[model samples]
Target chain A: MGQFILFLVLMTLGYLFGHYAEKKHYKSINKREKELLKLPVISCKNPIGNDTVAHVKLSYGSVVISVDYFKRILASLYNFFGGNIRSYETLLDRARREAILRLKESTTDADQIINLRIETSSIYKGNGNSIGSVEVLAYGTAIYFEKNEPT
Target chain B: MLMSNIEIIPNKTIVTGFGVVSGSTVRAKHAGRDLMAGLKNIFGGELKGYTELLEESREEAIKRMISQAEQMGANAIVNVRFSTSSVAAGAAEIYVYGTAVTVE
Candidate 1:
């Protein structure tokens, strides 16, 4: 009975707080994404054209996001149902976008970022086979030209 | 040294290629960070501690790769790639590799 009460309290807290945090983070991500629309991130293996390249460097961004107790339980229940786990979809979407935003933020002065790649990994699975957290890494090559010519 | 994920470095030309070089490191989560993460599991937020730990470990791996390229007398590393794997329960291994080359 005591364990059940604790679990109930934890689920309630997780639901409330997780919802709030997700809302806040989404707002921030949307605003920043619009602000950074000018910089192009592409997956092409090479630069577009023959331009005098002044510099080239590797840029990367990584983030680790933890699953709330509520979502973990929700996912486990979904697992038994064997359907889409809607709870984790938003979590992964947020992590990927946040990682890309950070990558763009790191190389603001660069002309373009090419050969972009994103990696996702589960960092830890806590006791009882419950997921603890996941990590996302976004990386690309930031290319700089000799001069920014006005078109 | 110049580093990029692409095959070519735009204006630079590859004069000599010194084959592939790689570096890897495995890191285990500390008890303190795990404890904090447990608290965060209820609140649901970013795990900044784990992020920083990953970044530092990656940086260390890159540094080691660069040193190896330096020994080979290479000025650049191109086609750089990164990979991660779980070596143990609570530990992650970050591996980085690239082809070392001299550019002109």
Candidate 2:
């Protein structure tokens, strides 16, 4: 009975805090994304023009996000049923977007970022690979244009 | 040294190619960070400690790669890539590689 009660309390706290954090993050992400709409992130290998380019540099962003107790339980229960685990979807979505945003933010002055790649992995597995966090890394080459030269 | 993930630098010409250079590092956070991350697993949020650990490890790996490139007398590294894997509980390996070359 005591163990069950502890589990219940942890789940409640997890739900409340996790929900709040997700909502807040989505709001911020949406706003920042809109503000950064001008910057183009592309997966192409080559920059279109060769003449106007000033310099190219590497840019990357990485993030680690953990799932709450409630969601972890929800996902395990989902595993038994064998379908889409909605709880984890949002976690991954947020992490990927956040990583890309950080990458864009880091090179705001660049003309464009090309050859973008995103990588994901689960890290810090505690017990039975049950308690682990998602890590997303986004990287690309940023192209800067010549400042004083004519376009 | 100039570093880019693409095969060629935008404005520079590749004068000489010195082959691939690579580096890797394995790292783990202290016990305090692990304890805090455990709590975060319950409440659900960003794990800042783990993020910092990964970033630091990646930097270290990139630095090592750069040193290797320097030994080869390369002025730039292009087509760089990064990979991470968990080798043990609480420990992660960051690996980075790139082609070292001279650009003009």
Candidate 3:
């Protein structure tokens, strides 16, 4: 009975610590993202078969994206023991939407964007700190497409 | 012997290489949902890492590319492509490229 109580206390402490750490990391990333959004940018490359080019430049702060196999196991264990996973999906969805909105506002012409690309990473430091951040950069030649003109 | 000088007709298009762009970092955490995602991936499911972030960035990059194309007075962009690289340990770059052209 004593061992069981001790284990419960340790688990609770671990959960609290993990939650605090995640919040701290998120706050820092948000601060950096704000700083990046303040910079000025322009797009200067013209697309093929079009005249008049507008340069659009965008920058993003750091984001941490983690894919932990062990975490999943723990989560499942909790569910079998009784917990929920809906919260995780909600968080990811929210992050994605916020990032998209920022990107959308950074441009003047939404119709001109083409050939888009996105990349992500999960970087780990030897000090047991893993940073997961997603940087989204959209760049395409902006041109006036004539109506009824085949692209 | 070197081949005689030959005239080459260049296409009425231009492309700017190595143009820089920016994107914003987006974060979302659902209390404790990522743990499930991690498990799902291990079970051979799709791993969507910052998908919204990637989608948004893709759009932004394309917008920037098109803006650049317009600035050059190009009618269209052809053979467009994208590439990504790490500018820093935690940051990723998405670049779009294509030939800016003016068609008659």
Candidate 4:
């Protein structure tokens, strides 16, 4: 009984430490992002005969995404142990929305966006309750098209 | 000869517009796990720390680049490319660049 109690205490300590460390790391990334945002916005100007087209570049960083392969295994494992998977979906959706919003701000005119592209990847790998970090980026150009202009 | 906007032409066309987008995050748990994994790899294990990080950031960056291109009223993005720089020992920057064009 004492050995089991000791194991429980140790596990609890490990969980706390893991949570604290993860939170600290997240804070640092947020700080770095703020600094990056403060930098001057850079865009490319294209010259076309008499008219010049303006291009805007927007960047979104450091979003955490769920790992499909791992999530499936985890869901089954948690279910077997009587836990829920809804939390994972909530986390993923929140990140996706936030990243999109940031991308939106990078451009002046929202209507000019075309040929959109999206990319996702893992930034960090974690253990146990802490799995990994995922990032999503969305970018496009902003242009002013003449009214009634035929393509 | 018929000309299509989607066709890739070398030297004849100039890149009218360019954009790049990137996203990155570093987590502590992963760092700890990777450190252990690296040590274990001495005996033979996959080195995935950098690979996983770069792959995720690369995808996110490319997505942002495409979105930027679309916003420029570009029908297509050509000469798309990707580059990475080590911001720190365990941290990296993934960047995607492409030429945005409105073809005739």
List the candidates' TM-scores in order. 0.95, 0.95, 0.32, 0.39
Residue range A56-129, candidate 4, lDDT tens digits: 22333234343333343445577678866753454455455445445545543423433334555444445453
Alpha carbon deviation, residue B71, candidate 3 (Å):
20
Q: Which CAPRI category fits model 1? A: high
Off by over 4 Å in 1: A149-151
lDDT, residue A36, model 2: 88
Model 4 CAPRI quality: incorrect
DockQ of all models, two decimals each: 0.80, 0.90, 0.06, 0.08
Minimum summed lDDT over a 10-residue window in model 3 chain A is located at A123-132
Tens digit per residue, CA lDDT, model 4, B1-104: 11111123222354454443223333223657567544422221123454455446566665666666677667556545444444554566765555676544
Name the TM-score of candidate 1: 0.95
Task: Please tell me which model should have the higher lDDT, number 2 or number 3.
Answer: 2
RMSD of 2: 2.1
Question: In model 1, how large is the Cα lDDT of residue A18?
Answer: 96
Candidate RMSDs in order: 2.2, 2.1, 13.9, 12.3
Ranking by DockQ: 2, 1, 4, 3
